[model samples]
Target chain A: MRLLSQARVAGSVLLLLLFSAFTLPLRASASGQVTPQTVAETTQCGHVSLQAMIDEAEAGDTLVVPAGTWQAPIRIDKPLTLEGQAWPVIRGDGSGNVVAITAPNVTLRGFVVAGSGKSLDREDSGIRVSAPNAVIENNRIEDALFGIYLERAADSVVRGNTILGMALPISRRGDGLKIFYSPNTLVEGNVMRDTRDAILWYSPYSVVRHNDFADGRYGLHLMQSDHHLIEENVFRNNSVGVYVMYGTSFELRRNLIAANRGPSGYGVGLKEASDVLMEGNRIVGNRAGVYSDSSPLRPNTTVTYRNNLFAYNEIGLEMLPNTQNNRFQENILLDNGEQVNVYGGGDLTRNEWAFDGRGNYWSDYAGFDANGDAIGDLPYISKSLFDSLIGVQPELRLFQLSPASDALDLAAKAFPLFAPQPRMSDPAPLTQPPALPPTPGLESPPTATNIVVAVAMVGVALTILAAGLRRSKRQRRAISAQPA
Target chain B: MNGKIIWTLAQKELRDALHNRWFLLYTIAFIGLSLALSYMSLAGAGIAGFAGFGRTAASLINLVLLIIPLMALTVGAQSLAHEQEQGTLAYLLAQPVTRVEVFIGKYLGLALSLLASLGLGFGIAGVVLALANGAGSPMAYISLVGQTFLLSLTMLSVGFLVSALTKRAGVAIGIGLFLWLTFVFLGDLGLMGTAITMRLPVEQLLWLSLLNPLQVFKMAAILDINATLDLLGPAGIYAMQEYGAQLRGVFLMLTALWILAPALAAYMRFRLRGDF
Candidate 1:
């Protein structure tokens, strides 16, 4: 009996230590909401009002909301945890913010927040968090003017949420997730579609990773933000994939920016930015893969593009005439309409096309590697006469693939007198393309139907040819046998 | 025009074309070269699998642009000029058939032969591509075939105009080749040079480009394959923006106008001329 009592006391002490380990962070962040409350108070409001539960609860109290459509324009003033048993709906009255969190350490998850006001001036949103350390995760925000607005919410986490903006005209629609003055915010694994822009304004040290932004005005528009890391995100079919204006020390890695084809269809546009590093990106099928306009504005700052694949774009790299201090190295510029075009009538000689004796692989580079060192013996020069003319007069690009343009270039090469000056030259261009990470989601292999169609077409063509020949031969034999 | 006389004349022309050694050789060469071109395009991409129909068709665009018009012009030019040179056209003209009937009949026969050659070549190439790689969407390939057919018709109409004006087969063929060269190179180069020198407005440039039947076919083919005129650059984008949903239809109409204008001119010249 004495030994059994001692063992029970030891187990109780261990349980207490484990419980405190879990609760201590919450107790410290919640600002002295230390009373441990058992039994998460089920909301008495049911479908009527979740705000009543928030009003009745103390700081750090966890409220369990049942699955029902609740009227929003709700506010959480104290630090609280609102957990939905199922995905509950919070429908706004189309006036102001739908679900507002004004208290620090508030956690909102497992809810479908919808129908905010259409007022861009008021900055209406489905979930507006003004307090720091807010966790807004796994909730689906739909048909809201602004999906999620994080205003001054430092160290906030916005994860795994699906934000679909209102179907207004692109200019009229608000941002999907507008992070204003929110420092060190982690926006990861979220999807934003059909929004005007996903704006990161003055949000320094933010990490936006693994998100998908598509069919918007600007996929990720960063303005005056510093030291942001955007990695492994997909920005597709937007007007501009990622436009960085006046940002410093931005790193974009392994992101796929594709098919942005709007008016200013840039996969990644940099305007007066400095110290930007874009590495390992697959920028494909865009109007211009990377557009630089007066980038690296400050002296001694540099913008570097390394190991990116710029494929099938109209212009792989388009820059302003005076844009300088940009370095492009170890990149594969494959089959763009024009590899690099300096917008207006100037050359890209100011920017460095090679660094450390390594240059990019130009698909149109005609030089061969004689010594098998994988470097071209002749320098890769961009001096096509037609390309230069098209740069001056873009409408002449209509004849880009015409025989006339080919003949013009051929004549220029033969005559050498008519050839324009080199726009830019890489001293050591790679004869072979550099290795690139395999693109995700390649097309499936040919199906049986594809084979059948191909065989049938070939058969038909050969049969026609055979029939024609046989008919002609018979006609000749008949005429010859008739005794002329 | 009497349908019976036209049919009889067309049958004669068709039989002659099929019997011609040069025509046979040209058809074989076209088919062989097209297939080889498709193969090279696929292999050149360094891809292990077959490229999609869009890519294969794109690679064939330059070859088609170079060859189809030349073949059509040569065949059409030889049709009337060779017969006239041998005095057989005069013998045929003395028959009950009218000049209009003979003209329409010859055009119809050559059109059928050209269609057969193009169909055989592209169909075989497309089938091989489908079997080898995969046909992502056959619409672009089908569109390319249709555009080439229209281009052949347009060039053949222009060839008939040349033959109507010329007497000797050598002279007609030479003129046809010259016109082919002009259509292939001069128009685009002249316009590009002019645009560069004078800085022509995009609208005017588009209009000038549309005047060239070859450019019309190229733009239409590219637009159909890419589903956007962006590849054509600013003039193409201007066309897209200006024409909106009517861009493809406009190109088709332009190609038709090209065919009708030349065919009409040839008919008028053949009717009014007293050379026979």
Candidate 2:
């Protein structure tokens, strides 16, 4: 009976080996090699057309395209994920979008999408999303008119994608990520370059963070949108860092806007935009740091600026005369050609320069403290005769600090009637520039001078204190007749 | 004004101020703070050596705007107030010196002292900054120093006027501190508060700024710093257009008027005084 049972086991083992050999090839064809058995609804496409496999896939299935270039526009109509096992390149022959997403809950990840149609009017994109809640992540798109175009695709996520556009002129090129009428989208961790605009058009309640936008016309161009959160993005070498128009209640924080030197060349431009909470953003090396044209809607409404660093710009903050009720506090205005430039004459005095005994650090503030208080004993006033000339002519800025200008300033000083009215004033101006957190992508190497100066300052204070104590003791004892 | 009598009284005033340790303190404070500020500005950038001309000039501007005015105001107020309190004015008046001569003489002495202190303080700071940062723009820095002196003159005039108004040295000192606080600190707060509470016109704000000599100095000196033009904003732009080539000249003249008007008022008060 033992011998018979052993023979049966050997036969069963042989049968199992034969069964595995016969079904493995079929399983490989049915499912992707990377995830053969783990994913129950995975369909692998190799040597066969991706469209054919996609057609065969059931709803809610995943189609894995492995390691080959496919030359056709793909359309997804069912709820599924088109995952690239080896970053499959989907090429288009200049007709329609390379990948058309029409179904809800569709995910297109790990793709190398390239060569969309060349017509600007056609709005051809590498991936066009028409359905809501679509996710386009970890895709590398190149040479496309529009990298990712979403129309009415609300609540979608487009993350971890690097989109490279062709070197077309600003007018000829399309946006890297174009979202139209799409609300509540989250765009994160994408590095987009050489596009007309990294983000274009309107998306209400969208969160765009951690994306690096470089060499574009506009890093983020939002129009007629409301309540958007844009933070921690690096916008460098763009024409305009961020062109926000008519956007209300937007929270723009901690963004690095640098080296945007295009025609408009603004780190952040606001036109008729209201209720903007711009905090902790570094507006560095731009032509104009923050340009606002009628940004405030109501007479009493205000856009707030707190703890922002405006450094190495031609003009730090330029606002229109109509832009009123704005507040600036705790911001470091450093090394800008102009700290605040208003056109056509406006009352910036209505705007609060300091709140709660704290104000911005103007690198040009000529104030000092004598009584050991860190606050400057005098207020820092900003006013320039040259500024007024430039405002009216917009041409005399060529001779900004020329000797002629200096002579003119000297003459103004000698003549009391020539003194121009001050534009703004900050009471309690800090003696030291606020110690700011390092900005990402714009951090400078550390230096040791601050420590040395701080130590020296402390030593001086100690000496002064000791001297004062000794003097007081002598005077008191002499007066009381208690000295030996 | 008798130049000989004024000159003689002015010499006496200068010798007294120098001997009293006030001049030393002022000059030392200016030097220490200016150097500290220059170093501080460079320290933040983590850059040693030269931070360029614009940056140092900018820092110096801050120093001048705050310290120069306060120093001038206190010294000017104290000089006259102390003389009146000690009965020296009566003695001097009895001895061939007219009240106008005493007033002009004291003003001249105080102005020279302020100028010397400003020059010495800034000169030392400038040399130190140049040594540390290589060389920036000497002309601009010098121009800034000069403008600060001009600001000092205006504050001195304000001081003299205050001294002439008050009878006691203590009162003069109190008023001096109060004026410094008001013009340099509280004035801005009040203006900004009024602007918020009452949406004052840009023109009105500019006019109101003229009430403070420090503001007058700032408006004039801001043109010297390239970076400050942008901060001048639209109103400044408007002024630039209106003032044109005369902008600086007008500002200087205005600041001078700030000096001359108050000094004249103090002289008139002294000339009319029956207490002497």
Candidate 3:
């Protein structure tokens, strides 16, 4: 009886904690009354352009438009909240915008906006926002040039919008949230497909979270943007999934990027991007996986990856030579043919065995961890072994995994799973897995993993530079003699 | 074979391209169209009621990829085949140059022409796009140049190879088209089939793909870009993605072979083996 009473008391305390956690976010939101009368008092419901519906409104106003097909090219410019009643269809008159807004602290919810004409110039918007603080939620936009555009808007939120179209097969078209020079925007819980790029941002500090993006050139795209978070999104069969563009710093965490290969395409393309954090995402069955290609003029872009689960992708995580200063840590990779090869000729720090000298968990890792934590404490280093042999020997990746794979794992420690030495990871000895079983079968027999692939190209700038140095030539010649 | 010879040949090709304003116009059109598309593509995102729907369809990745193969074929068709069609190769070869030198020189010239086309055409297009898009990927812009270079070299080499092997202009064009289609379209399909039948992981199949230079070049370019590293499914792709240059050594070797073997074969046939 006493134990039961104690248990009830503990349960009550836990329930109290749960209740606070749930209510805290709601409490944080600005307190407002949501009565229809209060909303009517705040807004001016008139038969005007879509912009008027937004401008003539104040905060906490829900503009209930009568059931009528409106015109296209409308603008919203205000800090007001508007909600359409029933299926309030805003139709473009084949010329003007359906809804154009330039307002801060605005929300446009539950509307069907469609039927805009296409033009070579004058990009039409189904629901365009010029305000920084805006939210276009729970809206269905279809059959317009651009479904919804957020231009030069910052710190906006676009949630629960379904956008669909086929404007031009070759040309990029209709967007759910086309954010140009917009920053700190959140596009969450939307379904976007059959367009050019699903959720694209030129501005930084954005989040495309919990969205379903399918059948676009790029599912979620960020170009020349930075500081974005892409989480829990489903990208299906897009040309490429979640393309993080150049000069962008972002985190693609806990998302499904899959099946993004159809009718001439790649899965994900990252060009000239830097300072990336990809964590706990599931990249599966795509044409390729996370490709980063930069130029010679472009400085090296840095990326940090951790705990990502990748499977059935082509060229998983490709980094070029111009792209320097990138790191991968503690990822769960499985069923891949070959893992972790580099191109573009740059420095490679294969510190798989750094943290407690353990490497990432690869299903193809022939090595074993005698201990259980599923981490091979020994460094799993296959430093360009296949590349070195591929010249004279054609069938290199034919037989087993890297024979010269000097893969090893350190003994299980309290927190060292690849205790990175600044090169591979930024902060040494970061967080540890909540709990990991010590892997018993780790550490493949040591072979020559560091077989430097000395490609003596006739025209490559690096090769010419190497030839310019005489003493280095002698060293290279000497090394070439029993190197293989 | 030397830099000076290649440079001179490249200079000549640039001169030829300039003289042929029609050819120059072709590139200019592509550049203008692509740039214009960049602006028009964004319009969908602003269609008022349908802005949300419009943004979802813009896949610049696929659009760029679609442009490449066509670019390769269109540019490659004009290589030696055009000169032969104009009956100018015989005159050039008759002048004080060895067949080997002429072959190397013409290939170099073609490469330079391709570079010019890229720098002026695609590069300008990319810049225009960057300006218009207000936030475009610089990496993709640069990648377009790289892909153009590698693809042009491959196509140029193939053109040279076919031109050297055949006396007929029609044959050269036919062969060039065949090569382009096989590489750009069927190469991946073939490898995919092989992987499925061989029951090997895609990474393990890369060694076999080395035999096919087109697949190798595609893979190499992909690796060079480093953006699609994660998209590569096999363990090999992972290795390439992580240690792209180190692992791409194989593809580089293959690309070198892809460029060199055809050029070398063409040269060998032109220099040593008498035709007629």
Candidate 4:
């Protein structure tokens, strides 16, 4: 396999070679194995000569489809590459799957794979991969049990694809792209619409990035999965943007979520989820944003919410009663009905005011910036002010709803909005924003704080290692009946 | 005089137990297995819900599986038959020790030591899990230990009863394990199979399933003791409630039998025998 892959790499384009060259061992050079392994053994599939195409295919052959309409399911049993020539169309005969890749290393690309949804037992769908390492990229998928279903497949990559799901589920069972018991998968640069879930991870170590997910029951969901990285995905008009339950370890960063609503679900729901680090995501305009409330499994869940923007949601934040050991820090909360609707539980600390009157902006703040430096002199204690006014006198809620009101005017001028916890601020707020590269992607720029967070993790890891070694020495002494 | 003789007999039984090599080896094996299950739970298994799952009053559900038989076979099966076969019973009986004294002494030594060993193993496993796991309340730990002790005592009584009834040690072991294995796996399985096989009314099946000892234990384990469920159907929310209550009663009755039946059998057999 090493010799074969090396031979293939030698035949690959310069950029492909560059990516592989650094990581791959030099034992299998292009000089000996590249052309024969990759180029010579390619499977060219077509309706006219199916048997001939199958014959041309070796164990690890590449099946290349030219740009033409083929009315059949492209079935591959062995290890083979099924590459398309500039978006070739694979139209099904109102039957089962458009393509079924059974063996490993089968790559499908640049095709309009459509027309599934036949029998209830046998779902009509775009692609069904039963094995690992099957790359389905740059393809147009429609009307299926799943756009790309990796049933129990592992280590696959689904990227740069435009996938549209069949409307409502049969018995509430439909997914745009789903993977099960799979790890190290990369789902990136995809446009998904009208799907139950844009991406779903089962067992974990999957990476989802830079995808546009809209009009789905849930944009992204994690269940019984671990160590997944969900980065820079845009979730729009979904019932629930992200629903994580069971056991999940996700690194959620730099995602834009907006205008999602649910009767019972959340914009970002964490139920029974554990070990999550969510940072730098823009969350807005949901029935409720960031619901980290209680579930039966809440006792085991711990998540860190940091450096994100939470604005224009019905409820800014919710901490349900059963939740524990969760920390919030350095985030902005602006323009919401209730800024912090803590459900009589959970812990919060280390958050900064986006614009304290001392430099924070609460949209509803009555304090003034006398120095004209875009900051008020006093702090904002959102919890206390709300409690004193609306909580004590429920009727004052309607009275203060007006932007410009009567007796409320005197209250604002007299007192400072006392923030519950002390704010952790940037000593040097940007006078003028620093110039950054004009990159066109959802991915965030690697900031100094992000780097420090990463470095601090390494430092902690080293400390743990040292402690572990010492503990081992002590255990050895105890076991040998000697004092350390 | 009778009391002194009984004391001497009890001492002799304890000495015999110490020398029983197979008994010692099997005890080690059981310890190893329980330890392994504890290890698996702390690390994380998909089925940790069922794996090494012990609660305050219910882990006795697993008792019907192996522990009961283990206790029964080690002491109950071989107690009389082995002594008779080795011709030691004749020699002991020739002395002033009455049959009642001999029976009490033998039963106490076997029951106490076996129960103690089982308790120690359970304690060790609980400690290992507590040390390794990231979190678990002390209440949960105490609950587990308490339940384990209760189950061990119940099994010990059952073993004693089995020992009394038969001259053939193997038969006694078989009978002891038979009750245990039936309750552990067979009873629940039979009930489930009956429900599935006979297109019986769901409600009827629900009522009948209460008889299965395994189901009772499972109910106790799954639903702790704060409250009880009362079912009215074969399946669904209401049925789950009913099954809970029914299983609790069943486990309690079965455990009582473990105590009453074995001791009664030994007493009757000892009284009827003429060898002494």
Candidate 5:
């Protein structure tokens, strides 16, 4: 009986220790909220500077900045949590970073950071983090050279941040979120606009998702990055949507890159990038849907375009003619002026237009399918002697679809010598356009004018036929009345 | 081969055409349609005036394709068939002119009337378009006019062949309309339908285009514009490269042959039959 009582006492002690381990932090945080300081001594109240409070507090302390504008650059050199009660504004002196996190394991949340220097060389930012494992979330940053500059800040998380830049030109303004050598970073739910770019410079394995980047020079500029996942982002009204230069093994999925009209306007440009898988992305209303140059570093690289909807672009898929092993499958190329225009004078036969049994759905395909097969009976061949001649002489594009061009095509057919090679062919063409998600506010159907014209033509033809029949019948009667 | 006799017969035929008011009717139609289409092209897309002239040529091509063939065939067929039915051909053959001379004279006179009609119709449009587009590729516009002329000649020859084969004026006119419909509309549809059903090689489709004179005209006009060549697909590019400079010449020769062979056959049938 004595030994059993001793055992019960030991079990109770163990349970008590576990309860204290879990509840102690919760109780301390609760108390800390009431008085705003429990772990370390901080400024009580009154009008004390934020720097004074930081200097007085311990390294691991929590400082709650009051609901007022903190002046100039606030340097955080300790592992601390600077939480704001009512979104305290940290107004910079227009010289350097407004809030620079130089120490690791720091969290800066619920603050409005603004006003950095205009010098691009110094790399001024609203919130600049040089330390690893820092979290900068729920912050409203504006009027900054760079919104959030993370230099060597590996494994950091910058989420739910709204980054807005000044009204300067793209060349003068810094990026919305510039990550240099920051690997394994998660940049999510950031709304950025009017910035130079959302850049990833040598930032490998970064996951940039659900961000809205608009009205910038480049929506997302990736330079020498590898193995990045950019998904569900909307890049609208930028100069270039996603400029992937020297990027490799990137997964660009379900993103909408649209209306990016500029000098070298491209929805997505892949320059020497290899092993890029672009799928389910709608690249619309740009000069070039996807401008692909040769992957010179990696020869015989296969860049794929799968399930993409390329629409209303000036030139869709403007790639170098010698870009070998590039495959396009199940893409809806709808209403592009030139569906596929080659940059140089070389054969594009090496690029595969269809993979497996399915090819792209061209909006202009006129072939019909009998026997209820959804695939076109013949291969969809996209070529034009006019397109070829316009490639050489651009002004001839003004005479596009002219009868003279049609005559030249007839001439090409009559004489085998003038026949140009097909630009591209889809072996298994789809009868209907694939059901892509409707873009909001841009659901433009095919022109009603063309349909009206066709109907008018049929009506005219029927009328002409009826008139001719009557006249011929009258002529028959007249002939019968006359001597045979 | 007597130049004086051929000239006299041609003059008589031209006078007969003028008296029948066929030339005036065709001239009015060509001018009216061409002007209306040109104005519509200019007014379209909100780009009024000179900017639209470049676009006008493209819009008028279909009109030319539809109207010229019907006019050419009906006139050519009715002219010869009506003469034969009236026994005027027999009277003319009884004169010093040979049957070959009669055929050539009639064809040349018909050709002159067609040229006059087409020239009046397109010449006004060309001048207006050139002024509007500010001297837009006049060469291209001229080429379209030239193709229309060739197409008309070819259709006229086809009408001659139909008229020569039959005796009744009504039968000749009916056959001429059928030929017009077949060549202008049905020939392409049939070839395309066959191609789709049978999965014919594009090369075969390319060569088959030569068989129809109107198709030859269509292809020639389309290929003259650089962008339309891509619509021809890859085979067109292959054809362009293979033939290079010879492509245009080859099509022109093919069109010329379409004119000559039918007329020659009609002349031979006329001479051998001696029915007139």
Candidate 6:
């Protein structure tokens, strides 16, 4: 009897040791003191219970949220890594921010943060981060007033996220990404569409690269923000592609700005901006490619545009009367309606059109190149009577492309008395257009409707031609048969 | 007023047009030029990929603007003046036909000839372009064709006015050419010069520009290419803002008025002075 009782106590002790081994980590995780190994063992949160898991998680603990719709207005006050396995949705109950990160070093990834409040005054957002060193990436955020609001969050990295704004009108919609007072933020590889703007105000030293912003008001709107490096980004179908106001020292390189037609309709607009270097950008199909109002505002500052291609825009470059210190060189201005327009009527003699014996290739330049050199012998002058008249009176542009305008130009050429003063002169205009990056081709294969339209047009033309000919032949026969 | 009499007279006029060497030459030249323009526009296709239908149609605008007006005016000017010069109108009027019937029938015949020429020329070119490059925005191209037809009718009406006013065919053709030159060149240049000198208000400038049918056609064509009419600059934006939803309808109504006013004037002049 004594031996059997001792064996039963030993079995009970072994079972108790195994139970404590498993329950110790659970208790540690519950107490918010989880080590890395303990977190790994107890990381999986119950489906649809994300806030509870986040509440119990310690600082620096990593939580793997399961795939389900999790209720939101989730607050992470401690530094933690919350990763979703299969894009678990954190849906707000139609009120405040879906996910708010109030602590430093928080990483939120692979989650769909959606359904924020629609109050613009409240600035409701899908993910609102207030602390620094937050990395929010690989998330799809949609139906939110603001996609991501990084307020005073320095050194934050927002990468590979797709942000779609609400279906509100452009004026009512909030910004896709708002970075206010956040310096040294890196926004890369993100796709933003149908938002007001990806605005950065007082946010200096920000690097925005490789992002696609479309169907918005302003692609990247910078106000009083300086020292931004914007590269390899696409801004298309916006009211204005990149508008930098009250800023200085911006470098925009290799960006594509296209089809931005709105009230202002500028691909790149600068007001009171100085020391801007715009290089190798393809600005195409906008109403005005680059519009400057008092740009290079400070004296002794130069705004340089080099090796950029301005093609198919209504006005390649438009500047106010006082815009000066702008140096344009080695760029290609091709097929724009007006290559360079001086808004409100003035000459661009204050700005430099050629530098270092090289100048932009104007599609309307009629000068000839001699001695096998690419540069033209005679200086290229942009002086049109009609363009000047339209400058003074913009309503006269209604007669554009009329024969009278061409005649007026011809008369000015024949009789220099009627010729207006040259708006600009390029002493070393290029004979050949500079090589540009190939435009990304749009896929528009011919559909069945196209084929049907083509065939029908041809059939109609031939039928008309044959009927006219047959009727004419019958009339000729009847007239000949009658007495002559 | 008699349909059978008008149809008979129209058939006779059409037979005369078919036998005329200049008409045939004009049709052939139009087709050749359209084809060449289309081919030249697509020359950059090797670099820019397949040039879409919109770009090609935009390029064709200049050709249509220059050629169509000249063709329509010359044909319309000769339609009545040539018959009156050859004393065939006296013979026709003596044969139980109203003067209205002769005027309406002759105009209809010349209109058909112009339509046939334009349709054949643009159709063949359009087919070639669609076959070569994928047709991007066929509606834009079709709209361009429709605008060109309206322009032709407007110019033809003006030519009929010149024909009714003149007694000699050569004189009528001369006056038509002069009017064409004036409309194409002097009118726009004068308006531009005046606008610069006077700084006319936007509304006044728009009204003055719309007075010229050629300007209307150019604006309509540009609007078709760019739906927002951004290329027309500030004036275009102002027009869009002012007309808003009815901009297209406004253009059409203005064109119709252009056709009707000159045509009614020509009919009145012919009816009053029906003596051969």
Q: Each model: TM-score of chain B?
A: 0.94, 0.90, 0.73, 0.72, 0.91, 0.94
* Cα misplacement distance, residue A348 of candidate 2 (Å): 1.9
lDDT of 2 by residue, B75-120 (tens): 8788777888999878888987677788888888677667666656
Query: What would the per-residue lDDT of candidate 1 be over residues B91-166, giving only the tens digit for each residue?
Result: 9899988999999999987777777788778877766666555454665676787899999999999999888888
Candidate 2 regions exceeding 4 Å error are A1-47, A443-484, B1-41, B47-276
- Runs of candidate 3 with Cα error greater than 4 angstroms are A1-61, A77-80, A172-174, A199-202, A262-268, A294-302, A322-324, A344-347, A350-356, A370-484, B1-276
- What would the per-residue lDDT of candidate 4 be over residues A205-314, giving only the tens digit for each residue? 88888998888888888877778788888887887888777765678888877667644435788877777887877676565578774432544555776656565555
Worst 10 residues of 1 chain B by lDDT: B44-53
Q: Candidate 4 DockQ score?
A: 0.00
For lDDT, candidate 1 versus 4, the one ahead is 1
Candidate 5 docking quality: incorrect, acceptable, medium or high: incorrect
Model 2 residue B58 lDDT score: 52
Q: Could you give candidate 3's per-residue lDDT for residues A159-202 as a string of tens digits?
A: 89998764575374655457898888888888887877765657
Q: Write the per-residue lDDT of candidate 5 for residues A1-484, one digit (tens) a residue.
A: 7556545654454354345422121111111222222222222332445665566555655555545666758888888777764677888878888988999888888889999998899999999999988899899999999999999999999999999998897789998889999999999988898989899998899998988889898899999999899998888888899989996788888888887766567899888888888888888767678888874337655788888888656677777775767888888886666788776544567777788877888766878788556778788887766567656544343333334456666777788787878877788888765555433223322223323333343354344333323334455688789986
True contacts kept of each: 0.37, 0.01, 0.01, 0.00, 0.01, 0.40
**Residue-wise C-alpha lDDT for candidate 6, range A244-359, written one tens digit per residue:** 99989999998888889876899999999999999988887788999999989878998999988887677889888888889999898866778888998998888888999999
Top candidate, metric TM-score: 1
Q: Is the docking of candidate 3 incorrect, acceptable, medium or high quality?
A: incorrect
Local accuracy of candidate 2 as per-residue lDDT tens digits, A1-484? 7556545654554444345433231112212222232222222333455676667676655555555677669888888877775677888887768999888999999999999987888898989999999999999999899999999899999999999997788889988989998899999999999988866457899999999999989999988888899989999998799988876888888889987874467999999888888898888767789998887774556799988888767788887877767888888888777788876654467677887888888877887889866778888887776565555545344334333345455656788688878878888787766655555675422224423333443354344333323334444678689655
DockQ of each: 0.37, 0.03, 0.03, 0.00, 0.03, 0.42
What would the per-residue lDDT of candidate 5 be over residues B135-222, giving only the tens digit for each residue? 2354565577778889999988988888888898889989988887777656665665465567666567667756877767766886
**Weakest 10 consecutive residues, lDDT, candidate 2 chain B?**
B44-53
In candidate 6, which residue ranges exceed 4 Å CA deviation? A1-49, A66-68, A85-87, A297-301, A350-352, A438-462, A471-484, B1-15, B18-59, B92-105, B120-136, B264-273
Query: Could you tell me how far off, in angstroms, the CA of residue B218 lies in candidate 4 after the best superposition?
Result: 57
